[model samples]
Target: MKDLRLIFRYSKPYLRDLIIAVGLLIIECAFEMIIPVLMSTLIDEGVPAHDMPVILRQGGLMVVCAVLALVTGLLYARFAARYANGFAAELRLAEYAAVQKFDFANLDHFSTASLVTRMTTDATVLLNAVNTGLRPLVRSPVMLFMGLGMAFILSPRLTIIFLVATPILAAMLAWIVSKVAPLYGRQQSAVDHLNSRIQEGLTAIRVIKAFVRGDWENQQFDEVNTELSDASTETFRFAVLNMPSFQTVMYTCIVCIMWFGGNFILTGNMSVGQLTAFLSYVLQVLNSVMMFSGVFLQMTRSLASARRIREVLTEQPDLANADQPVTEIENGAIDFENVSFKYNAGAEKNALSDITLHIPAGATVGIIGGTGSAKTTLVQLIPRLYDATAGTVRVGGRDVRDYDLAALRDAVGIVLQKNLLFSGTIRDNLKWGSPDATDDQIWAACRAARADEFLDRMPDGLDTDLGQGGVNVSGGQKQRLCIARTLLKHPKVLIFDDSTSAVDTATESGIRHALAQLTDVTKLIIAQRISSVQSADLIVILDDGRLHAVGTHAELLAHDTIYQEIYQSQKKGGDPQ
Candidate 1:
């Protein structure tokens, strides 16, 4: 019921149309109900006495009732369609907006594939359910009681036949609902699993092909596909049982009605028209029950989807701006005072432990860390991607939490390890950080990042289409283009998380030299190669998520054993792998 209420809340704007649809549905059903009574009058008085005028009059009334039913049914369909589709569009938008608001911590509770399924397939199920279920939801009970009332009027004893039939069908449907409801949940899970595999395989298709793992990939896909198929088969099998059970009960009641009703007519207790009308009411009563069963099955599936959808809709982000946020960033100075962070609340240990560090405004700082040392995690804090589990991190001499999220993020630019470029022209990817940047400004950033070295050779230059994820460009080119995109933002603080690893040492040096000219910018570079950060004014070495050493390249090599070993390793291998 709570899930149902959530769906209705999203449907609030469309409620007027839904109410209008329900009203028209009731009127259409009322007109349908009157047709049978008109048929009874035509058969009883006109047919028995050969009264042409009575027959014509009753027949004409039946036609008018039929036309009225058709018109109202059409109007009901129009309003129902407007309500259902409008509700679905709004629900999907709300879900997308909710996902956009989720911070890294909140996002950890769900997966990319799981979120995709909830927003798409689950929302689709609800759309279809609402569209198909509206009529039955409104009409079934109305038709049932109205049919029953008219049945009792025609022959009360014969109406007793339905009581036995109704309960038998109801019990069977109740059992089916109980069995199928849980299976629908499992079925949706299977779909999520299948979609996860599909998304991963497609995204990493190049890696799979390079490794010649096509057979292995197929086997993985087959496992999830079969699981989905089996779940769908089992769920629908039980759900479809409703139709068979309804038919058996309905036919049994009809047989009893005919057998007992024929006796009533012969005994002069009922007329032909009355017996015929009673049979018509019996079909309506049982048909109404059938419609209810159909809706019951649909809602069973919809409720499962509703629960998943509501989970996203109701989620509270881990981060929000302070009530009175500091909207301006004064400078690029960053400080971490007694900071500790755990990705999960109940995690056995923190990813980064109690450590303090400070980088002055406009300082070029190099961070070298071993794997899992939380180098990337440290920079992510600047933009409040993930809040610290303990202590405070300050930027521009104020707590990062004090500033509005947009203001803080806009002041800090980060080029991630993975150089992801969307499918568009090279100019589109380059100007992503500053949508309104002039072509000359874009070219200047490109030269600074050494991206112009390749763009000069391409026939289309800036107009060149990069394809999906910049698949058209080489690894080094993609990295350079990504750097250019970030540089275009002209942020106060720039953090490069091993973003230049794809390029050679000389090219990387050129890029660093370009960065050196930005006197007002604070640069934090994380790299595996010692040469990449060897020229920084200050170097910070991290080992196992703790601050191991902070010194210039010469100062570190002279005293720090860890820095000395790293330098020797890179000297022997050209660059540390």
Candidate 2:
């Protein structure tokens, strides 16, 4: 119930439609309740008296009531649908927008598949609850009590039968709901697992085919599929138990009513018309009870989904701008003071340990490290992508945390280790670096990154489409495009985390020469090949999570054992000429 608060908040804007739908529902219920009285009147007086006028008049009124009821019911459905869909759209948008505001740290709690399910599948479930519940949730209690009132008027004795049955049915519904609530939670978990399996299999379909591991992927998929099927079956089986429970009590009540009402008619205590109308009202009352049970069951399932949605909306982003932040960077100089970081709060070991380093405003420095040395982690701190677990990261002599996130990121551009391009034309993807950049600037950036080599051969040039993740281009072309995009930002500080690994040594050297022309901007490069960073003003070698040595390329070759071995290994392997 606490988790359902957001649903009501999103529905605030559609209150008018909801109110109108409820008003129409009340009107329709009134018309339906009136018909049984008219049927009783015609049977008791008009039919027995053989008066055609009474019979015809009563029949005409019933038709009019039903027609009005039908019209109002249809109108109610329209408004309810509008209200539900409108709220659903807003809810999904809120979930998506909340994620956009989340810091990188917040993402550690949610998986890709889980996020997709919460936004799409869980949202749809709540939408269904609104659609199926809109009228029934209100109508059930309204009709039940109203029908009972009318039933007692016809024969109080028969009404007693209803009094005995209602509590038993209510208990049954409560028991069923209690049994199914946890199952619904399990059912949603199963859905998440199934989606995870499908997403993994689809995203890695090419790799699976190349490795001839289709059978293994299929087997993994089957496990999740069976888990989902079993969970859904168990949840729905209990959810649907209310119907049989309602029927069992309903028939017992009807049997008691007929036996007692027959004795009353024989003793001249009740008329045939009253007995017939009484039975009709009993049916209406029990049916409404059953309707309430169904709506209650449906809401239990929706509440499970609502809880999942709340997890996304209620998450507070750990990263935010300072109350009053420095807007402009002074220069490209960077400093890391006793910085240390661990990925999670309870992590046993730091990904990057206490380290202090500095680079001049316009120096080009190279960073080399073994696997799991936190090379990418160190660069991410500069852009404030992930805040350091401890210590101050200064950009342009100001604490990075003191700068506005937007301004800080604008001054620092990084080409991530894993380059990605959205599904769009090359020009559209490039514009992400600078939305308003001119074509000439774009071309210049492309030339600097050597992306022009391929663009010049393709007829589409910048207009060429780069399918999802730039799959239309080779890995080398994709890396170059990413670098070109980052160059368009004209950032004060540039950090490349092995961004040119796919390119050949010749092409990479050409890129480095182009970067050297930006004399005022600072550059930090992380690479596996010594040739890629050998010419830097300073080369920093990392061992584990600590900085092992910092020196010029020649100095490192002579003095640093780790740097010497890496260079020798690379020289043995030879550059990709």
lDDT of each model, Cα atoms only? 0.92, 0.91
Task: Give a tens-digit lDDT track for model 1, residues 1-577.
Answer: 8998986798999999999999999998898888889889989999999999999999999999999999999999999999999999999999999999999898899988999999999999999999999898889998988899988888899989878777788789889999999999999999999999999999999899999999999999999999999999999889888998889889988898899989888899998998888888888778878988999999999999999999999999989999999998999999999889989989998888887999999999999988999999888988899999898899999999999999999999999998899999999988788999999999999999999999999989999998988889999999999999999999999999999999988889999999999989999999998988988989998888888999999999999999999899888986732
TM-score of 1: 0.97
Q: Return the clash pairs for model 2, or none.
A: none
Give lDDT tens digits, candidate 2, residues 153-217: 88777788888887898789889989999999999999999999999998899999999999999
What does the lDDT read for residue 196 in candidate 1? 97
Question: What RMSD does model 1 have?
Answer: 1.6
Q: Which residue ranges in model 2 land beyond 4 Å of their true spot?
A: none
Cα lDDT of candidate 1 equals 0.92
Q: C-alpha displacement of 37 in model 2, angstroms?
A: 1.1
